[model samples]
Target: MRVVIALGGNALLRRGQLMSYENQLANIRTACDRLAPVAAEHELVIGHGNGPQVGLLALEGAAYTDVPAYPLDVLDAETQGMIGYLIELELGNRMPFDRPLATLLTMIEVDPRDPAFENPTKPIGPVYSQEDADQLAAEKNWVFKADGDQQRRVVPSPKPIQVFQLRQIRWLLEQGSIVICAGGGGIPTYYDEDHKLCGVEAVIDKDLASGLLAKEIGADLYVMATDADAAFVGWGTPEQKAIARAHPDTLMEQHRDEFAAGSMLPKVEAACQFARATGRRAGIGSLDGITDLVSGTGGTLISTEFDGVEYRD
Candidate 1:
C-alpha cells in the first residue's frame, strides 16, 4: 500500500534536549530503523517538521550584526534539505544497498488572503521565560505567545491550497524509490500582488500538508508519527485513557479537548481529513510503534466507518 508518513519535529529533536547535530542524527537513525522495514515492503513517502531547527537558525542569524536574518521561507527550505539528507542517509544505511532514496524540494501554494496571516498562531523557535520573551519581542519586533508556562515565537501558518510537482513524487514512488519531500510544509509559497509566485514569511502545518499530499497522491493509508504513543482523551489527568482505534467522527465529537493546539491537534485533524477524504484509515502514534501501527496492532487508527474504540484494559 502507498503510505505517507509525517514525522513530527519532536521526533528528531526531543523537547528539552540539547539541539546538537549529533543528537538529531541519532534520533533520525532511530526513526529510520523503525521505517526501514516498511520501506522495504511498501511505497513510502516521508514528510517532516523543522520548528526547532528553523528557530535555532533564526536565533543564530539574529546574533550576527552584518547581514539581516533570513526569512522563514529560506529557513524552511534549509531545514527540508537538512532533515531530508539525514533521513535518506540513515534510512538507506538500514535498508538494502539497492533501495534508492530521493528528497524533493517541494513547493505548496497557499491563498494570500488566508486569515492565519492576520493572526500568527504557529509556534516556532525555542522556549523563553516571560521576561526574556518580552525583551526579544521589544528588540526584534517579533510576536510571542504563551506556550504552557513559557513563551515562544508564533508565526502565521496559512493553509496549504495546492502541491506542486506531485506528479514527480508519484513517478518516483512508481520507480520503487522512497521519497522524502514537503519538509517544513513545502516552502510556504503563494502568488504575490504582481501575479508572480513567491515565498511568504509564514510557516505551513506539516501534518496538514502531509494529509493533503496523501489525498492528492491517492495514498491507501496516512500515518502521522509524533512523539506521543497514541491519541488519548483526558490526556494528562486521572481519567486519561488511550484510544486504540475509532471512527474519526466519533473522536472529533467526543474527544475534542484531547487534541492540544501545538502538539496532537494537527495530527488528529490531518488524520481525520485523510480518513474522510478517501474513506481510508489514518494512524497517529509514536514513531517507535510505526510497524505495529501499520499492521493495526498499535496506534490510534482514525477511520470513516463508525466503530467503538479498541481500548486497553
Candidate 2:
C-alpha cells in the first residue's frame, strides 16, 4: 500500500514551547517512533508544515544580515530541506528496514494572479504580545494580525495547482523508498512568459499540497497527522461529536459551516478533494494514532462511500 502523510506544525512544536534545535529533533524522534510501523508497512511520502521554523529563520537572517532577508518562497525551500533532513535522519535510525529516504526540493505551481497574493492570511512565526507585534510591524513594514490572545505574522498562502516533481516522486515511491517531499507546502513558483519557472512570495497550504500530490500519485491513502484525535462535528459546541466514518459528500454537507476557514477547514477540504478525486480513503487524526487510524479505530475516515467500505490494509 502507498500513503501520503501531512505532518502538522503544532505536532512538532507545541504552542508556547521554546524554539530550539534540540527540542525540535527530540519531538521529531518521538513522532518517528510512533510512525515506524506505518513506514514499515507502506510506501510512504511525508510532507510537513513549516510555519514556525521558516519564520524564525527569516527573522534571524534579517536581524543579522546587511542584505534583505530571503523571500518566503526561498525560506519555504530551505525549511523543506531542513525539516526533511531531520525526519530522514531520525526515521532511518529507528526503522528496522534499511530504506532510502530523500527530500525533494519541491516546487508547487500556482496561478501568478492568485488573489491570495494581495491578501495574506496564513500565520507564521512565533506569537508576540500586541505591543511587540505592533512595534515589529512598524519596524519591519510587515502586516500583523491578532490571533487569539497573541499576535502573529500573516503571509500569502496561495493554493497549489501542480506538483513540479510528480514523476520523480512516483518513481521513488515505486522503489519502496520513504520519500519526504513538499515540505512547507512546496517552494511556491509560477511560469513566466518565456516558460521559465520563477519563485513567488506565497506559501501553499500543506494540506492542499498533500492532497494534490496524493491525487497525482494515485496513492491508496492520504493521512493528515494533526493535533486532534478525530475530526468533530459541531466542533466546539456542546453537541460536538466524533465522526468515525463518512463519505466526502456527507462531510462537506454536515461540517461546512462548523469549520474555520484558516484552520481545520483546509484539512477537511483537502481530505474531501483526495477522496473524491481518487475514490480512496483519507484520514484526519492525531499523529500518534497512525496505527489505530489505519486499523479503523482512530481518527475520522472519509471515503467515497460510507456503507460497505473496507479499511485500507
lDDT of each: 0.90, 0.87
lDDT of 2 by residue, 1-313 (tens): 8888999986678888888998889889988987889998888899999999988987998797678888889999889988999998999997765688888999999999999989999889899999999998898888877778889999999999999999999888887789999998999999999999999988899999999999999889999999888777777787777778888887787667777786788998999999889999899999889888766678889888685322232
| Candidate 1 least-lDDT 10 residues | 304-313
TM-score of each: 0.97, 0.95
Candidate 2 deviant stretches above 4 angstroms? 307-313
Q: For model 2, what is the error of residue 60's alpha carbon versus the real structure, in angstroms, after optimal superposition?
A: 0.8
- Tens digit of lDDT per residue, candidate 1, span 91-125? 98988888899999989999989999999988888
User: Model 2 compared with the native: what TM-score?
Assistant: 0.95
How many pairs of residues in model 2 come into backbone collision?
A: 0
Q: Can you give the lDDT of residue 135 in candidate 1?
A: 99
Backbone-clash count (model 1): 0
